[model samples]
Target: MNNINTRNLDLNLLVVFVTLWETQNVTRASERLALSQSAVSHALRRLRDRLSDELFVNGRGGLLPTPRAIELIGPVREALAQLDGALKGAAPFAPQYEQRKFRIAAGDIIEFLILPRLVAQIAHEAPNVIVEVLPYPQRNDISSLLENGEIDLIIGAPGPTSASLRQTPIISVPLLTLIWQKEGLTQERLPLNLYLERPHVMIEMHQRGENVIDDALRAQGLARRSGVLVQNFMAMPVIAEQTGYICNLPAQIAHVFAQTFNLSCHTPPLDFPAPELHAYWHNRFDTDQGLAWLLQKIRQSASGP
Candidate 1:
């Protein structure tokens, strides 16, 4: 389209398009926007005419984006985010009573440590607020999600460096070796030989990839015997109890799991520094009061329990 034709387009149509793409249902998108279903449908029809494409089509369970939508979604979402941030100047956030929601992207490990405290505080203070936790996305989607304001915070490895992002360390604790007593291990601290010889039940977030411990082992030209591979830390206790495989986990959570299961926690025989977890957010939201409040809550969650 020419500049004149593009200038004739309504900005509200783009908002409707992004909402539909996110919700993937006309009814849900309309409800979210406080618009009647017919009004949302009409907006979509007008958008299709201006863009000259069937942006979405009926699909199983919900609407699916066509090729054009997938192509344009990124740019449209970014543009909307910039405008939304500019317009949200110095709005006061009332955690005590605001009916607001904050979505966070985090791994189960951090969720194990932080969610309990965060939820308790939310329930006590902000009865009407919602806290949604989503799994950490892959590399590229992390940047896209933060820029689009889809998530308020992300807790995991550092993402791509960008001027729009702000990040700070969350926590770091030594990794301890976890083992079932049936393994006949009696040293006050596990021996390096036993550590390397024992069959290891490992947590590899990326399938078949090395975790922090494995990476350190590789640096010394050593590796552990892999008996089983699981995805999350929550499952390791069960497998360790039934089998004699050794598992490694962060010290705090490892002790918690040790007391619950009949497993024992020992200082890891290897010498490597603990990896740091960090929280990331978009710089554009520096003045978003709700986000600022929630960030403080998260930091408090990490400081104690």
Candidate 2:
């Protein structure tokens, strides 16, 4: 990196390099930058001469970034975004008149717990805004998605490790029991023996790993029998409704399902600290007023009536 001198380097060429890396097609890069194909080629040439590296190479699908180009992308993107933000200045975010889209990566249970009120608030306030709620992805992962700006924000437990990332706790969740009313579950709370005796429906968000409750129970030298293992949160309550098996879940979500399935909600026998939900965003976007405003709305929705 120190080998290249910035004094002779044109920032426009870096822009072109980044665009070509993103679009992976010279023609599309030219279209996005509003430059002639030959001009874009000239910029690429300037980039190669300035950096003395073939930053990109043609592949079967499109242009593939070279190893050096891959190494340079994160810093380059951050520099460009910083420059853009500075030039735009700190304009106050006006939600009522703002027209923007936001993407949130969260799981089904969170969607059930948070989205309806959020959507309603946005509709009434930021009427021109659009919201896209994506199911928590398993393959590509949220860290890469948030870093690359594919996602605007995330609502889930901690995992991202990038230094440019920031997170804040958004929800305090207590564990509760969802049981069929006919199961003769205690109105106040289920006894520990009853909790262990009944077959339990366990939720495994990733379709792997032990049930989250298992860890807490294991520490106390106790464990419950999982009559079923399910992937999605919705299925857990439904199975409990039909099979008379008890399912333990966050209180917010359990009550909603109980209302829907004509089931009963009760306190779980064991005491566990509340699990938390967090909102994560890139540090680069900390200065984005529009995003800041949307984040406030999400926070209000999570903690609202």
**Candidate 2 lDDT, tens digit per residue, 81-189?**
9999989896688889888889988877677778888999999998999999887766337567887889999877655456778888888778898778876665678
Over 4 Å off in model 2, which ranges?
1-90, 207-212
Q: What TM-scores do the predictions have?
A: 0.67, 0.68
- Please give the TM-score that candidate 1 achieves against the real structure: 0.67
Local accuracy of candidate 1 as per-residue lDDT tens digits, 213-256: 87888999999999898877898888988887898888868888
**Model 2 lDDT-worst window of ten:** 203-212
Provide the overall lDDT of each model, using Cα atoms, as 2-decimal numbers. Answer: 0.83, 0.82
Error of 2 at 181 (Å): 0.8
Q: What's the TM for model 2?
A: 0.68
Quality of model 1 by C-alpha lDDT: 0.83
Residue pairs clashing in model 1 are none
